[model samples]
Target: MKILKYIKTNVLIYFLIGMFLNSGLSLIKPLLLERLLVIQEDQLTLDMVLSFILYGFCLHLIFYSTMLLANFVSNNLQRHLQLRLKNQLFRKLFLEDAFIDDEKVSIVTQEMELLYDQFFLPLDLIIGKSFILFTTIVFILWQNLWLGLFFVAFSLLRPLPQWLMNSRLNNSGAAFSKNQKNFHLSVGDFFRGADTFYFYGVAREKMSMLEKYNEDYENARWRNEWTNNIVFFFNGPIEFFSQVLPLALGLVMQERGAELTTAGLIAMYIATMNINGPLQSIMYSVSDIQRSGVVRERIFSILEDSSVEYSYHTVDNVSELVLENVSKNIGERILFQNLSLNLSQPSKVLIKGASGTGKSTLLRIIAGKIRPDTGRLYVRTSKGEEFSQFQGNIAYISQHPFFTHGTIRDNLTFGQEFSDKQLLYYLDQVGLTGEIPSILDYHLINNGENISGGQRLRLELVRCLLREKDIVLADEITAALDRENAKRVRQLLSSLPIILVEVAHHIDSEMHYDQMINLKDYR
Candidate 1:
């Protein structure tokens, strides 16, 4: 059922049709050989050979058409499955009460891509090969029962070597994938702190680690290849036996004076050889199927594990957010505890905390990014009614802002339907109007790579202002900026009417908050 979950009905139908055509075509080869051998003693006419050629061509056409259809169906199914899984993942992320862990998300994304490749292709091959194998066996048994038995016995031996190879490959593959992930993580860490590396003059040392990882990856690839080749080598002898056994037995029968036509012997030999084709196909697909099983298990585990749930209570509108007896824990370590706070609209509060005092977690709880383990959050609307939901009223800006590779205007507007004048006004407000040559014509690289960190942060602030949320939860938004830019950003935020809850390490002069709630006081 787990594997079948990925198989859509239309895909199954397409596979069956393809299998039927392939089996029918495979039967033709053996039948044609039998007919040609039967007529070998007679005067082989041009018309007879032409008829045989036409029959073979028709079977080939059927095989080709079915193969194409199977490919089409498999591709479509793969596309749909990828989209469906992505959509589900997006929904899960959106509905969760906290930001998704980036590391976990990365792992899930890679596993999903691998699962899509492994499941659909192998399933198609397995379905088609099974049909061919079944039809070949049945036809051979009907023609000569003893030869069919021999084919079955020899075919049973094929799976052993394949099974051993598949086991070894899968184990090695898992190890390789893990090592590869570690390598990527290490490389990411190096590049993300290029400044540190340059300042410390440790670039060469870091590069050496990358080279070692590459060598390990290459070694793993060769190991997998060598293991598979050994299986193929073992299979070659089994395949040879498949063809030779029928011929040898047939000759013995003929020598013993049992009537065995040349046509019959040839047909039996072809049919025996046909068994290996399907068996080999199955072995190839089984490798992918095993890999897919690992991916499917990973995907299903994410889908099944419960995250934070949305509150059932609804509000007409929310004006104030309140957390009473709130606490949070990651595993057994309490990140925060007994933190009670209330934030009202059109007010500003500064949340000051040490590096690891959970200021960001507190902000997340208020912004509905996280649910406190032992407390209730009440949201009161401007009209004096309360609800348990946070929606359409809060904007959260983290320390590092995300920007799509695009123009300054696009980053500010965030793809929202904004007019030219509105976009320009917001950009100007954030002091980015002069940075770009033209407000309407500015282009930015992805993640704002072409821009400085201060510029990106300013753009993010502008984007948040444009959203016009009632409350803004900003976590170290100005940390990357120089003093001048930080001062400007502080002034701009102070002027906004939204209730601001900011997490800051340093508070400069003349930038006063209505309430400065230090997390250290609570601790």
Candidate 2:
């Protein structure tokens, strides 16, 4: 059903045309071979042989054309579904407030790939192959009832083993997926905090953790392989019998003096060969699809979240942000309780607290990056209507600013189109242009590796200010800046009308704030 929604009518029309044509062409070889066999007995007139060859050549042309069209349709459909599923999953992650393991995202991407191969890859083939197999059997039955029964019986046997081992396959697949996710997470964490791991001398500990995941993944893989081997065991003999049994039966029928032309026997052999391939595909595809259950579950776990629905909300105004009776906890220890803040007007609020006191967490909650255990957050308009979100009016600048691999202008404007003059104005406000003359068009490596720490902060500040948001949440943004640059940033914040919530340990005595909350005492 989802596939149909994205498939274009022109593409679908081509797909259908190709499918019927493929099925029609499957009988061509058998028919031509049957005729050629008859002509050989008479030493065949030139006219008869050429006519037969011409017919086969014409059918081959149509066969290749239909095959090309079918491939084009299926390839496009696969790409469309891949992108659609990816966007839905990406949107879910972008909106999720609660913790979702990074490794799980890695697993989700892998699952999408496997799902495409197991499910979508063979989707159109199911229709085309089933039709071809059904018609082949009907044609065989028209010639001889016993031959049709033989083909059907063996085809049924091939899938029986897959059914027997399906439960084991599902269990193994799920276990492998879990272990693989853990393995990826471990490797990712090691690289992300390689310096800490080295300083702590916990390389052995991380290796031990990784080994556990590796062992579990290998064990699950072996179990899945065992289950597959069981399936192959049954399919092997069925495949052999599909080809060999027909010839054995034909010889017996001929000895028993059955009435049939030599051409009919040759057609039967060609049909037997043609029918078995499609039958084998249909049978094994059933098990392959079943094995991808873990993949489907992992991908949908992100795509089917109810929380994503409420992430985007309407607000009448962005002037005020309210947090009522907010509480947060980490495990047993309460970070904060019954915390209430009402910012009716724009102000520079400094959150002061010792390390690990949840100051950053509190700011994240305000930014809607994390949800408090208990609280009601609302944005009130001048007309008195409340909305859950403040839209794009709240800009979040983290300790380490995020920068994609693109030009400075690309990062600053993002999706919002800005004139070069307007971009330069914001750049000037953030003191970015003064440091680097050609700031806007300047390209950065991945995550702005080409720029210094202060430059990164300034570029991010400019990026946010370009939107002219009503509020800014800066979490230790000036921690990396020198006194001169930090003083410059503090003065720049004073000039802006936006509400600023900054969590910084280093503040000059001259820096003024509308409110300062020492979180250690904010009950």
Candidate 3:
């Protein structure tokens, strides 16, 4: 039902109409064939043969035309569905606190394709084929009620094989999907660790592990395929009986003069053939849909899930921040406790702590990345805006900053509109203009691996400056820089006219700070 929400109502109606027309058109050929078979040799004429040929040609043209139209509708439906689903996936992935696991990643890349192919694409065909089966059955009953009843009974057994093996098919399908994802992850891990393995002289062992994963994936595929084959094996005989038994019985009824004429019996036989394809196709399509249950659920789960939607409290300008008795713990270990600090008047504050002293954790808490266990943080703005915590405004510059593979402008603006002049000005402010040529046009690959560590940190600072964020939380941003670059970064931070909260291992005398809190004293 949720999936149907993406489909346009008018378009769906048009498709169903096309399917019905196509099914109706399909009956014409069978009826024409029956007419041909019933014609006596003595009565056959050139005009009659030519007329039948013309009708067949016309029927085929209309049939294929309707088929083409239905195909276009199905493709368009898939496109619309994919578009909506893609937007949902993109929003979920970019939201704050979005944790992307392997399954979610596979949902975006692999499972989406599987869902379209197995479920969405075939869904229209399933409906269309069901229509064909129903119409064919009705046409047969119109010819002879007893033969139609026999067909209805035999058709009941058509789905038995699928039902009997439904659970196995579902389980195997899920297992195959799981193994496929695992195999992809294993391959990624193997490639990611390839350099390390070579350095450690254990590449062979890692390769062996990758081979094991491959074999497992293959085994799962084989199991899923063979299980389906077993279902098909049972279905084959049922289909044979569905087609052959009806014709044989029709012949017997005609022989016994059971209100069945030769023409009617032959027409019913022709109609039975029509029913066979759609019936078998419907059964297999149902099985295919059932096989896609896991993937379908995985995709729908994300669509239906309520992601953590935070209403950001907007402020004109942040002027103060206060942490009251903030405490954080990792199991039994208290990283820090009873930490209290107040920063006002757009002041500079430095938190000095040794390793394992919750320095980064504290900064993340202020940036609203995580919450403190036992205390609250309050935020105040120059326009008398007050809030219990920061929301959607603070700029966080981590030690290992986030970057995508794009030009410097792309990284800086993040698709936001920023003029070249404004971006270059910020680049000049962060001293990045001197180091890289064509500063804005410089491309970064693999999270700015092409740039130096200091340059990467400086780009992050430039991003904050471009955004004019009122609050900045820098976590050991200059730790990896040399003395000159470190001094440059420290001066840039100290010169910014914003509320700055910096946590670093080393405290420089050259750095100006209105407040300094050693986290150890709070403990």
Most accurate candidate by TM-score: 3
- lDDT (tens digit, per residue) of candidate 2 on 412-504: 878688999999987787677778767777988879888899889988888777777777898998888887888888788778877788887
Model 1 lDDT tens row, 253-314 = 78888766777777867876777887887887776666455556656765655662344333
Write down the worst ten-residue block by lDDT for model 1: 308-317
| Backbone clashes counted, model 3 | 0
Candidate 2 matches the true fold with a TM-score of 0.87
Question: For each candidate, what TM-score against the reference?
Answer: 0.86, 0.87, 0.92
Off by over 4 Å in 1: 89-113, 116-119, 164-170, 255-260, 291-296, 306-316, 329-336, 383-385, 478-495, 506-512
Which residue pairs come into collision in candidate 3?
Answer: none
lDDT of 3 by residue, 1-523 (tens): 7777777798778778777776765577677777677668998999988988988788788878877877776677678778888777866654445555664567787888888777886786788887778788889888878788886678668778878878898898888878877788888788878889999999999899889989999998899889878887887788667767887898887687788877777677677767767767777777678768887887787777775434455566777788889999989988889888878856898999899988888987887767799988988777876797567678888889989999999999999999999999878877789889998889899989999888898888888888887788988888878888888888877777778888888888888889888988877
132 in model 2: Cα distance from truth in Å?
2.4
Sorted by TM-score (best first), the order is 3, 2, 1
| Lowest-sum lDDT 10-residue window in model 3 | 94-103
